[model samples]
Target: MEHIVNMKSLTTEEMMKIIELAREMKADGIRKLDRTYYVSNLFFEPSTRTKSSFEMAERRLGMEVIPFAPESSSTLKGESLYDTVKTFEAIGLDLVVIRHPRDKYYEQLVDHMDIPLINGGDGSGQHPTQSLLDIFTIYEHFGQFEGLNVTIAGDISHSRVAKSNAESLKRLGANVTFVCPEEWAGEFDYTTDLDAQIENCDVLMLLRVQHERHDGEGLAFSKWEYHRQFGLTLERAERLQKHAIIMHPAPVNRGVEIADELIESPQSKILTQVENGVYVRAAIIKLLLKGRNE
Candidate 1:
């Protein structure tokens, strides 16, 4: 509870507590803290949803968000991540949220820092907040996780979302399946057939291909081919059960990861996931700060 670093480190009870708090906050609406807290975000990687969602969460909680640009920071002078974090600690900030490209980047800062650190993301390591929001969305729809069939498809090797969600969902008593091409499977056992799992799964979670992480190598098939085979084409989406939901942690590739029309379809919870992110993150910050004070 000290730092929201990895989903694997959280107990089932702890995870549920965050989800419950988020749900309550969503129902009750924003309630600013009696005292103001100052926070800063250090994202070394490119983002849209995660970064903005955290800022929204911080603002809603009445925390003063200190904006940061990695390009203009001391990092440009070769200052280390540890030094930069230490600098923030010295600046009297209450907490810091960081998203760095190095996997497990917070490992070096967590033990030494005085304030709590909420990991925005770290390489292909884990995205705990995103996982929480995704779980919240799922829980909101179904009211439970036990025995839910969750199939995650796409660039599993390079996705922090896939890694975080797979573990957390399985731990919460959901049956989790991974679908990806062999080259993108990474450490998990997976099948290349999205079609086979589509009808049976209660959740079809698509992922972006993450071309940036593929180094200089190109896919053997074109984007259209990938979409036809693995992506959620209109035909594939029709095969989903009525109760089934589609989700993507997006900056969506539109037609690349899913059919463009399906992004806002009735069964798609993609935007709801984004909306819930702010609440889930607010709950996390509240819990971490509450724990720190006690």
Candidate 2:
């Protein structure tokens, strides 16, 4: 029943070490073939990057990837999450990757099972894998997060991205700042009174407001004000540290969270983040499996 729940299992060094290994696995050139190892992804909600990356990770490592999309799974037919998990466990899956809208969903399941859990995300609580990929991308680009001023903007309250990013960045030596409308700012509920949380950082990490997740949460706001107050506009982008980089964990809310202009800027690393994500996930799977025997 052991598991990697949120960032608790990773210190800055261990996390970076995993990401670096993931990179090497991705670059191995020769694809190994092993159809015996089974990995299951049990995600209750929708995700493109996460599911795909996990799928690619297993495939690249020669493991069998169980069907990932929730819509295509038996859970859509009134099966409780626990029942679904048990079914997968019964089938002797080697690893489980889960994402659910409720925080602690996997931890509760882990309490009952013999399998290992890799939490894709649990509501707005945390997305550790994404955080690792983000740090890896930044480290690969700049070689360091320390002394860098990095800003995470948008839907801070309900964004696992912002929460994990802030913690992950700081743990890795970056000075982190968060920007969002007061309602959706970082989960911390307080900023240190710096302008745009942009005073002196090397990067700006923009987060997308989950429009669908906010529908009933009462955190939704008009698109105009959203972009006006927090987005990276032409003028706003001009104010960054001369060498600052722009980052976003994508499925970006283009016109709303970031102006159309900044997405294509020389500083933008949105696509790069996506690419590195697959590599990092592959690395994690390899690391976990390789070390399972020890």
Candidate 3:
């Protein structure tokens, strides 16, 4: 069975194939999978877009989805994650999509389970599916990843999306730049000037300020200060290249990562990203299932 733990697990060809499949799926508006598999969604962290989109994808593909609620389930009663996953396997669930708050948490479960394990988001580790959908969205607009100037701004250290995207985009031939405060910048091609990046980038991807993951000492700057320094304000949006676009993995920290008006602007591809997520996830599940059969 094939488990999508991170973007690194996938080759460039494989990523391209998945994006092609996603595009095909979107254009056809049809689910082409056999619909014989059952999948479980085990999310230990809170989510709005990824969780719902995955469920919608499963439903569209005609697969049985067993949503796992860790809060109310045996996990609350102190059942181990391993045990909870094992129980699902025992109940005949064919695969598991997990979102946890620990880095590389999926690694621990993949070997212990018989079914395929998909990483939804493993706490500040990697969000491969998000990156896949992001690439699909970028492709839909820009037609290709090669030579595209893509800027990822804000909260880099705690962003799984940024980590996965930087790796995948670079591999796909996009010039990836990370823009953030010095503390958050970690061994990347980084810049502190958001305006300079916006002027040059074909795609400007903004990440939310991950206050949830902060150690209280980091991101010490005020929201207004952060906005002044790095946020995608109206002024910055106006200066974007004629063909440039903005993107965010939602649950946006409104004024921190981007202004509310900018999110609804003509240059914003945020909603498109959400919509493409469903198709991309559907394609991923179908491909994984096909791999199992082959």
Q: Against the hidden reference, what TM-scores do the models get?
A: 0.99, 0.89, 0.96
Q: After superposition, how far is residue 33 of candidate 3 from its true place, in Å?
A: 3.4
Runs in model 2 deviating more than 4 A are: 26-35, 72-78, 189-196, 215-221
| lDDT per residue (tens digit) for residues 1-294 in model 3 | 288999999999999999999999999985646656788899999999999999999889888888678878989888888888899999998778999899998776877777888899988889999999999999999898899999999989889999999999999999998999988886666789988887889999999988888867656778999998999988898889999999999889888889988888888999999999999998898888888778
lDDT of 2 by residue, 213-286 (tens): 77676545578766777777777777777677788888888887788988888888888888888887777766
Q: Assess each prediction's global lDDT (C-alpha) against the native.
A: 0.94, 0.76, 0.89
- Candidate 2: give the clashing pairs: 22-283, 146-173, 149-201, 149-202, 156-184
lDDT accuracy of residue 238 in candidate 2? 78
Local accuracy of candidate 1 as per-residue lDDT tens digits, 1-294: 899999988999999999999999999997898699999999999999999999999999999999899989989999999999999999999999999989999899989999999999999999999999999999999999999999999999999999999889999999999999999999999999888999999999999998888898899899999999899999998899999999999989989999999999999999999999999999999999999898
In order, how many clashes per candidate? Answer: 0, 5, 0
Ranking by lDDT: 1, 3, 2
Better of 1 and 3 by TM-score: 1
- Report lDDT (Cα) of residue 213, candidate 2: 72
Candidate 2, lDDT over the whole model: 0.76
TM-score of 3: 0.96
Best by TM-score: 1
